[model samples]
Every structure is written in C-alpha cells, then in structure tokens.
Target: MLVFFIAHFVLHWGWLVLNTKKCFRRNKEIKADEIIEAKHTAID
Candidate 1:
C-alpha cells in the first residue's frame, strides 16, 4: 500500500514538472515570434 502511494505521488509530480516545462517552452517561443514580428514591422 505504501509503495503504491509513493508511486502515485511520483507519477503525479513527474507529470506536473513535464507540463510546466512544456508550457514554459511554448511561452518562450511565442515571445520570440512576437519580438521578430516587432522587428520586422519596425524595419518596414
């Protein structure tokens, strides 16, 4: 029973960490795209 509980906790934490990393990466990409767009608009 204790082992099952530990396994469940670890799985949940791993999922949360992976999701957070994915979200952070996506946000960074979006910001980078916005910056590029701004630079292009400025040049034009």
Candidate 2:
C-alpha cells in the first residue's frame, strides 16, 4: 500500500513535468512561426 502511494506520487510529478516541457516547446514553436509571419507581412 505504501509503495503504491509512492509510485503514484512519482508518476504524477513526472507527468506534470513532462506536460510542462511539451507546452513550453510548443509555445516556442508558435512564437517562431508568428515572428516569421510578421516578417513576411512586412516584406510584402
């Protein structure tokens, strides 16, 4: 029972960290795309 609780806590924490990293990467990609779009618009 104690082992199960510990495992659950670790898994939950790991999932949260993984999710945060994924979101951060996705946000960076979106920002890059927006910058590119803005530059193209300025050129045109």
lDDT of 1 by residue, 1-44 (tens): 99999999999999999999999999999999999999999999
Question: Candidate 1, which ten residues in sequence have the lowest lDDT sum?
Answer: 1-10
**Over 4 Å off in model 1, which ranges?**
none
The per-prediction CA RMSD against the true structure, in angstroms, equals 0.9, 0.8
**Every model's TM-score:** 0.87, 0.89
Stretches of candidate 2 off by over 4 Å are none
Model 2, 1-44: lDDT tens digits are 99999999999999999999999999999999999999999999
- Which clashing pairs does model 1 show? none
Reference-based lDDT, each prediction: 1.00, 1.00
